[model samples]
Target chain A: MRYIATILLFALKYIALKLAFVPLAVILWLCWITAANYRKLSLAKSDVELDKIDQMLAGIKDKLPMDAKIGFRTNIDPGRRGVLYFKSTLILAPRILENNDRDTILLIEDPHLQPVLDKNYECLERGGNQELNYCLMRRRN
Target chain B: MLFFAMLACVLVLFAGTSLSLTKTCGLSGPLRFPVAFALVLVILSYGYYLGLLFQIQIGILLLSLGLPPILYLAFEKYKSRQLNLSFPKKIGSKNLAVLLAILVLTIRFNKYVYRWGDWDAWAIWNLHAKFLFYPEHWRNIFTASLAETHPDYPLMLPSLIALFWRGLGFVTPLVPVAIAHLVLLAIPVTVYLALKRAMHSFAALLSLLIFCVDTTFIHIGGSQYADTLVAFFVLMTFVLYQETKVSSNRRLVFVLGIVAGSTSWIKNEGMLFFLVFSFSFLCFHFKKPAVIFRYILGALIPFIIVIHFKLKLAPANDLIHGGREKDLLSLISDPNRYWLIIKHFTMTGITDYWIMLLLVMIVLINKMPVIRTLPFMAISLVLVGYILVYLTTPHDLDWHLGASVDRLFHHIYPAAVYLFLLKFSENREIRLWS
Candidate 1:
């Protein structure tokens, strides 16, 4: 009877430990999921910025076609280190509308040209549906 | 430095010739002949540097330490040839290529990562090296200096580092750190090859991959901790045991005895592995009661010598004693703490991978028939033994085990990885590229 009772107690302890594993697994899964989502969101924001640059180039008619997709040469945020999104669309013949800016326009996309854009380029706008969207403009010293 | 390099080159050339000679005699594969040769060369080079710093005669020591194995291999070859027994070089070149790639990757990453971890590496391992490099401060080592906090730790790794410092005349401690990193990389490769010979290639490759990326293993490897070196010797001993068991080669067993002794010399926890291995081997191999007693005595001889040197010549400066009466009393008073220690063993950063593999192995065990019953049983015993160690210990469960989960796990990692891989490979063969 004593041996049986001892065995039963041991079994109960084993079960309790095994039960704790569920919560442990759940917590780990939640952390991994959140990290994955954050990475995806950051990457998507970069892609949107490249799209805006393309739109600005399209709005300004240089010899470059308005439909050209511009890849991001460099990503710069002037005021903050947080994630930012930008979009650009080509307006007809000679105008490029940067989602972040309307007045300061830039040249159309050229395969051979490497354009130097300041972090505070006045024509870059944030166009994503998120609440964090904002436009880039040169800050006066 | 130039002299050391030149000596290393000479050792490598000589070891290479020796390996080729063994290959010609049919001891190992034609493809593995070069790989084995190169590894021996590297080990000799490193060992020579260590031998020089410790004021040991390098040539005589190398010949004494390395020659027995070479001679044994040659004898095996001769015996096999005389008996007309066909020796197959089952190992292939593709596996060697993968190993080389992994080694190169480890080297590149070791160069890039400048940061070391806390606890054993920074506090004990690196600190010891610092003292050894600047020997004028040897007295400071025993003093209550901030650097001598964990003086209870063994000196094998720091001694190696000191040798590198003395031989190369380099001021930066990163030289030894890099060497330790290389050993860490080489260990998994060596263990994998050893496993490949005993089991299947796929099993070996998968085990190696798991070891390399396993968060705990990677963390230890990146730091200056002696755990990786300890695991390396443990695995080497296991491999030697398995090889000798299969071949009935007494000489291999003797070499294994030395390796096991070296494992104990690496750290205090290493003695546990040495004890476990000695007990298991004796029970498994010896049929007669008298022979078993003799076998136990033979194994204990090297262990005794190592312990004597550790206690008499280089006693730990810290307060902890190896065999204190108080330790025994404390253990007898509280047993529940032991079980709590066992519980912590289940917790790990990469628990998900471990769980998935465990589940897969369970399924495989049910499905596979040709998978020998012995390997499964052996692995299960090892896992159970690991858990039981925590439960049976007399130390404060939370304070002792909880504080050093990584170190505790690392000490037994070789056995754990081996057992895990054996179970993982039950139903399927390893597919390297896939």
Candidate 2:
């Protein structure tokens, strides 16, 4: 009877480990796939709209004062506008922009925003292609 | 030099809080690092909150950090007493192997952090760090208009990051990245120490392996999500609460209260965890009013900061939003919501290594003995808290559960392991892994 009980216990352990490994294998696979994709997405900044803002900032950074308060105009959806601010902060050199800071460089992505920005700030310079595009403007002196 | 200065300030405060308690209570040597690190984190969180409130200068920070050790040393001098600061007795070869395994696991976890941190790291925590680093505009992060950042979330993670930046006198992505990775590395070490005390070497090592292998845990820890930090404190509170039951030391009990209470300052769920911890402790030790009171009193230290932040600085929490009654009623009435939550909860929990955890427990069950009361009660209460949060959530049940139920499970995973190992360690039938 003791031998039989040991056999049953061994069986139970085998089954439980077998079941557990199924999910464990799945989790490990899912982790690899998701991690790879996530890395790609994080590094794919050049393909994203944020990269254009970075380029625009790069081209116009030398022209702006070190402490210049910059403005941003973008076509990014309302949900994603924070990303615009975050990525732009990294590329804008010593100058920084908070939301709606008065008398600042307005970096524009959408052409529709260009006229809106043009009305508010003096258009400083416009360059870049549709794929990687931007314009820099400053509030009227 | 400035960076080291800020770090030293944190260490001094940690030593004052933890070394005092550890000395008073005779806590074990293995516990010293986890307790010290957790307390230092609490101090850093407190320092940041105070700095924001006072707009404190560099001199004030230096003074706050320096004064504690000076005062502590003087108090010890007056008493002519020395702390028991020796290391634990030498571990066997197997134990050393486990330590080496955990070190390798942490190194891999750091690489994972390098690859993909949570979306929130870039979008929220680091962004807030930017605001805090720019001392003049730090206040702007709390603006009502910037609703997407969830500014109402407690500032401990961001504030700590910003503190590092303040020392460097500039903000860099590296600041948050490094802080997140430090917290990540601390998690496994925290687990290993807690487990070594509570379980046999093999059981403890096996449990640590479970934690290390769980992709969600490794991912979130690396991602700089506040979840793992919350898990660390929750696990520590559980382990320490178990310690208090055995030793009944007032200072350790008081320190436990502070650690548990500080969880509220980490995340909104931390407040719920703090409540669960307190209620569980009170119920478990109904006759021991003195112990309960000491714990509650210590907790009030961090709880005060949490209340002040919520009431004064933070915007209203997004979870408690407009049309509350209707949302609550709809959530309560829907059977589908219950099914949906259960589905996601199981799927995520299983995928997160619940299956492995259970299988290991079952295999070791014959070798295990009866459980302790406090750890079991604590685990049950925390699990119950997770379900309660999911059931009454004001957000859409699917979206809420999908995004966070797994993380919530992950939060309790360490505590669950500690509880499981505590029970397994008591078995007379099993002495060691061999």
Candidate 3:
């Protein structure tokens, strides 16, 4: 009886471990297919302009503290502009938004918006060539 | 290095708390790890609550003070087994099965990382983490302008992220990713341990793989939402409740209460599950009143934390705030809402893993035992509660169903599978298959 019990236990353990691999195999295949499709779509949507926006934001991020609030202004087309500013915010994140506030860091991406921003804030820094002009500002008051 | 240091501190607190709790209940070995981990999470969440209410320094102090006695007790327990902390009872084929599950889940989690989680992750959970990371300005998140972000959602996930980032002295997107992967891995680990305790090793491991690989579990678990975490606590509550039935250990009952109550800190749905668990325990075990008291006492530990958060910290939940009578009236009058929920519930289960689910359910029914039906009963009640939420949801019925029905079902799937496997393990006739 003891022998039978021990054998039964060993066999069950072996079977359980082996059977588990079947699901593991299935999951691997599923993940592979999912990753393939995801990578393809992500690669297709990759943007150089968005990368530049993020780069500019990264530079600003190093200068600001964790608690700093950032305001955004951009003339890139409404949809693409939102994407650019969103990518910029992702650099230092959590404190950046499109709102007016005291001691705010204004991120201006177009010269036209600069006139409006210049009324309320002083330019802190300006960068980028003619094709992608931008400025950083602080609230004047 | 900083991340590891902070994680080590949290794990020490978790291990000490869980091991001490297990010893208190006269339980030994690895099973206690998952339960202890869950309890520690609730405690850490409470610590976060303290930080929000008072000074962050005080919260950090409280968190730091919590682990020493618990660790001592755990050390005491381990010394008895010739310093063998390996938990030999937990070893065997189950570990092999668990290992394979981990490998598969690791791959799945990698995919999740590449995609950067789903919408609720970025917009809600991770966004909240950013807020919590700024202790001084965290309250800004609840301002009227941020209402769309659901500021009233429970803070367990964000609090945990903030706790780790504070240790590292900075925030990064990687924080949420690491947290998500840990939680994703935790589900299978917890399930395996809990099932091993409830049933045989083979049955436990088989159920663990099935539970882990379910398409819905894999898909939404990566989304970094509170749902998967909520599911873990819900399942743990059941697993702990099963332990209480086999042993007359009142500590186990108390632990069950803690697990069930901790759910509320995860999501509002967890609060509903806690109530259902309470009501089910009362209805089923009214003759055994101490069981009820023990469970309620355990639950109250976490419940106090939740009360502090809801009353002192969080905004009133938007779903519960206004036009309730009108919504209820409209929901009752419309038969279509009921059908829509039922249809989606059935359809999502079928498409996710219907063949396996149906087979398990049928076998469980055929071999159903009279003992300990309350856990299943509690889950059924919670499902009913979910449906009612849909019926009276302020959002559009179609949109709400489309968005959440599958994820909501995923919440209960693992526990349900665990129950069926427990039944399968218990049935002697089914032993022929092995």
Output the worst ten-in-a-row residue range by lDDT, candidate 1 chain A.
A81-90
Query: What TM-score does candidate 1 get on C-alpha atoms?
Result: 0.55
Model 3 Cα lDDT, one tens digit per residue, B1-434: 65565566676676566556656796676777777777777777777766766765734545464557445756676678443333344334446667667777867666655333566775677668778777777776666545556778888888887777776787545566666766777787877877677657887777766755666677788777888888888888888878878876687888888888888888888898888988988999999888889878988888888887788767878767775876688786799888888788778778985844675566655656634578767877888898888888889888989998877777777777777767776775653222
Model 3 spans with C-alpha error above 4 angstroms: A1-56, A59-141, B1-5, B58-63, B70-94, B353-372, B428-434
Backbone clash count for every predicted candidate, in the order shown: 11, 0, 0
Q: In candidate 1, how many Å is residue B157 off?
A: 1.3
lDDT of 2 by residue, B265-325 (tens): 8888888889877887888778988888889898999999999988988888777765576
User: Cα lDDT of model 2 overall?
Assistant: 0.69
**TM-score versus the correct structure, for each prediction:** 0.55, 0.78, 0.78
lDDT of 1 at A112: 35
Classify candidate 2 by CAPRI docking class: incorrect
Which prediction has more favorable lDDT, 1 or 2? 2
Q: Per-residue lDDT of A1-141 in model 2, one digit per residue for the tens?
A: 999999999977765654454444444554564456345545645144444555455667688765566666666566565666666654552355555545655554545343443576676677766543456766776
The alpha-carbon RMSD values of the candidates against the true structure, listed in the order shown, are 22.9, 11.9, 8.3
Pairs clashing in candidate 3?
A: none
Q: Fnat per model, in the order given? A: 0.00, 0.03, 0.06
